[model samples]
Target: MRLTVIGCAGSFPGPDSPASCYLLEADHEGRTWRILLDLGNGALGTLQRFIDPLGVDAVLLSHLHPDHCMDLCGFYVMRSYHPNGAAPPIPVWGPAGTAEQLAAAYGLEDMPGMRATFDFRRYPDAPAGQIGPFSFTATEVVHPVPAYALRVSVGEKVLTFSGDSGPCPALVEAARDADLFLAEASFREVDDNPPDLHLTGRQAGETATAAGARHLVLTHIPAWFDVDTAEDEARAAYDGPLDRARSGAVFDL
Candidate 1:
């Protein structure tokens, strides 16, 4: 499986990167199947630089925050009214009311919404299942809105994605023994940031250490925060390969 960082900025789009979005791809039955993790603000444009919008097979959203899901509206436009024709309804897994939230964003609450282009399925209620070559499990995380962290495995390699979470036991469980852990470090370790909203770099590192993750990729950093400081703080808590996620970065597992 290969993971591509389409965007990793937090809260909002950054100068160098868009908001939270990722692309995961793996070969299944002699064909590569693509899965998009989050289609956040400004990510649709950036995503085109990586792969065709129509080629994505499925989408998994962490929450309804604009930075984590606003681009789905733009994507709906692409899938609904392409020059060729309307594409097939791609499966989408997200928290409860995901379909409604996207409908409101697209100003289609009274219309067809994204139903014509997306097959929406609420998470937690949707049992862990196979999407092409990958098997994934979603666990609720600590966030103001409905959010979840995910553990996805292909063959013997497992990858965990911490979708904008603060320090939480569920995050540790989701990332447990993962070969690669993509964690959010939105807050500074020394700041007096509130709890259960976002994780500090140190907190991210601690979670990875506790989960015994082999490699850590710090992501979802806001533009204001210094990546160097976050990396330093994370290194103090974790003793493994660590890298700050950047747009266009790729990891082959």
Candidate 2:
């Protein structure tokens, strides 16, 4: 499996990276199957640098926040207006009211919204969900908005994504034994952050440490903060291999 950091900025797009998008791809059948974890603000444009947007097999949205899901508007336009004809509807798994939320984000009527362009479905609650060679499970996490942490596994390798959550047991459960823990670190430990909204670098590290995740990648550091500080704070808690998610970085497992 291959994971690409298309965007890593938190809350909003940063100069160095766009907001909260990650591309996960793996070989299935005779070809590659690609799924995006999130398509946040400014992510659609950056995504083209890696793979054809039309080639994405599925998209799993973490929440309805603009920085986490606003690009569906542009994506809807792309697939619906392709010169060859409308592309096949891609499966989009997200929280409840996903179709309505995306439609509202795109200034469209809530009835159909992007339904014709994308097949929107609520994330499967139990027994996991499957598409091609991957299986993913979602766990509710601590966030003011309805958010989830996803744990995706293909064969023996596991990849977990903490999609905008504060320190919580659900986050630890979602990351348990993951080969790569792509965690969000939006606030510095020194700052006074709101509870149940986001995680500090230290909290992210603590979660990974508690989950026994093998590797940790700190992501979603807002543009206002220094990424180095998050890394430093994480290092103090986690002894495993740690990396900061940068635009275009690839991790093959």
The numbered model that scores best in lDDT is 1
Mind giving the per-residue lDDT tens digits that candidate 1 earns over 1-253?
9999999999999999999999999999989999988999999999999899899999999888999999999999898889999999999999998998889877787356788789989896894767999899889999999899988999999999999898989999999999999999999968889989998889999999999999999999999989998899899999999999999999999
Query: What's the true lDDT of residue 123 in model 1?
Result: 91
Record all residue pairs in model 1 with backbone atoms less than 3 Å apart, i.e. clashing. Answer: none
Per-residue accuracy of model 2 over 1-253 as CA lDDT, tens digit each: 9999999999999998999999999998899999999999999999999999999999988888889898988999999999989999998889888899888877899987899989888864442688789899888898988898989999999999999998999899999999999999999989878899998899989999999999999999999999999999999999999999999999998
Q: What lDDT is reached at residue 86 by model 1?
A: 93
Q: Give the distance in Å from residue 46's predicted Cα in candidate 2 to where it truly belongs.
A: 0.8
TM-scores of the models, in the order given: 0.98, 0.98
Give candidates' CA RMSD values in order. Answer: 0.9, 1.1
Q: Per-residue error at 247 for model 2, in Å?
A: 0.5
